[model samples]
Target: MPTLEDRLRNCTRSAVHLEMRDEYMPSDPRFTAWRNGARNDPADSDPERRPWLRLVADLVAQGVEVRRARIVSEPVSDYIRFEHHLTVPTVRAGEQVRWLPRRRASGLALPGNDFWLFDGTSVVFHHFAGDGELAPDDEEFTDDPVVVKLCSDAFESVWRQAVPHADYTLA
Candidate 1:
């Protein structure tokens, strides 16, 4: 039962994340600040200010390909907008990001929950409450071949159709 950080740190080849929720961590301080008009400074490079950036950068440096794709609804939620605005540093850190409008995903088979696939073998599913807060005992990890293949296939399908972050615009 390794932690997410542990799994990430040990990841050797590739790590792909699929985000299907319209909102997450609704009460996160960063989201709150963004709601109030505060914005992330794209120029800010301090790891203390954006530790996730540091982690992704380190992984990329280690030759681990890190990628994330978000399936979002049209006329996106404020949270999505906030995430998009702050994604510059993430892109700069070396993770390839993409966004697929949920409508376009209607024909694709997708996992019920969002997840992270590590090296195409392991999967960590994330559970969230109605309020967009992570549920208690929030994560489920599995190495089952069926589940792993399902997630891996779903992610690749999404990635292939998704628009790169730099090219996506809020609808």
Candidate 2:
């Protein structure tokens, strides 16, 4: 199977990601630094510092629409707040990001895990441990039509209702 970056690089139309967890990678250096009061400049554009920016920018430059929708709880978790703070560069890289309050997602049928759907065809699910750490062999990929459709529909539903990241204020 191709690597996630390889799949993303090959995307011809779109790449969408749905993040349902409020906390992830509790021990991530960036998040740890944020917790210690080290703040990142949202306008910082050093690709080496944030590799995701490079990847997303490359995809967008190729006309592949990249988007991310996060479903978060109200009175957000510290991690979510940190994620919000770090999102500017991502948006600037051409990925449309939105936030949907968990309360507002009550009626939607969503998958059990976070996933990246590429070109409306393949899905990469991210599995994590209870402590918010990514489990070993964390990624699971599938091209099943039913799963692809489920993810596609769920993402669109959240995207339609989620507030653009620019307009969302931390609660």
Candidate 3:
């Protein structure tokens, strides 16, 4: 099986990420630091310091439109607030981001898991545990047309209703 990096590298047109969880990877050092009131310097775009930012930058440079949408619960979690604060560099790196309050997502048929859809073809599902940590054997990737269509449609639906990151606030 091709690695996720390999798949992403081969993506030509778009890479869309849909994130629905309120909290993620609590044990992650970055989150831990945020929990302690630490904040990321918006001026820091050093790929060495943040590899994911590097990836998003490279993909955008390649003309791959990278976008992310988060459906968050209102009275947002601390982690979500921290993520919003850190999103500046991510947007500056060229990834478009939006936030959707979960209450507004009532009628949409969303997927069971968060996922990244590449070029409308491949999908990478992120499974998480009850505590919101990534599942032990997480990252599931597939090219099934059915799953791809569902995720693609779901993402678009959410994106259309989401607020652009800069305008969103925890309510």
Worst 10 residues of 2 by lDDT: 40-49
- Model-by-model lDDT, in order? 0.93, 0.93, 0.89
Model 2 clashing residue pairs (backbone): none
lDDT of 1 by residue, 111-165 (tens): 9999999999999999999899999979999999999999999999999999999
Root-mean-square deviation of every model: 1.3, 1.4, 1.5
Worst 10 residues of 1 by lDDT: 39-48
Provide the clash count, candidate 1: 0
- Cα-lDDT of candidate 3: 0.89
Candidate 2 local lDDT, residue 64: 100
Candidate no. 2 TM-score = 0.96
How far off is residue 59 in model 2, in Å? 0.7
**For residues 94-148, what per-residue lDDT tens digits would candidate 2 score against the true structure?**
9999999999999999999999999999999999999999999899999999999
TM-score of 1: 0.96
Candidate 3 colliding pairs:
none
Backbone N/Cα/C clashes per model = 0, 0, 0
Quote the positional error of residue 141 for candidate 1 in Å. Answer: 0.4
- 1 against 3, candidate with superior TM-score: 1
RMSD of 1: 1.3
TM-score of each: 0.96, 0.96, 0.94
Spell out the clash pairs found in candidate 1: none
